[model samples]
Target: MRTYNIHEAKTHLSRLIEQALKGEGFLIAKAGKPLVKVTALGKPEASSTRRLGFMAGRMRVPDDFNRIGADEVRKLFEDDA
Candidate 1:
């Protein structure tokens, strides 16, 4: 880390940026108090691509899964006289 007064920072802005890109950071000060820290912004992370049926073989469905509750489900909705 390095410290620079306002004038020095302004005079050597380009050099400071180059240093920052190389992973060196510095602080800029006004009246001997640090005003801000200068550093490079890191590259963004890559996003993963989406695929359909990504969990196709990860789980199994029982043979009677769909018809297991058919009759009770119909009685709940039908009116009883």
Candidate 2:
């Protein structure tokens, strides 16, 4: 995809950032509308940098952390017993 405008995207701003870093996608009209869009900068689907108690002193359980239930966490994860 490609369109360009604003002065041909500022005189081909480095070939539209090398075709939006190679992933490709564009659009930037103006007097005709469709204002902006470039694309190719999306690689963080998700992540909370989790694990390890997920907080507080980073984890080192066994202080009876607390909150056990749901039938003692399904009998401490029993599979068939």
Q: What C-alpha lDDT does candidate 1 achieve relative to the native structure?
A: 0.91
Query: Which stretches of candidate 1 lie above 4 Å from their native place?
Result: 47-81
Q: For each candidate, C-alpha RMSD in Å? A: 9.1, 9.7
Provide backbone clash counts, one per model: 0, 0
Top model number, TM-score: 1
> Distance (Å) between predicted and true CA of 26, model 1?
0.3
In the predicted model 1, the residue pairs found to clash are none
What is candidate 1's lDDT per residue for 1-81, written digit by digit as tens?
Answer: 899999999999999999999999999999999999999988765433446776889999899999999998998889585
State TM-scores per candidate. Answer: 0.54, 0.28
Q: Which ten residues in a row have the lowest lDDT in candidate 1?
A: 44-53
Residue-level error in angstroms, candidate 1, position 17: 0.3
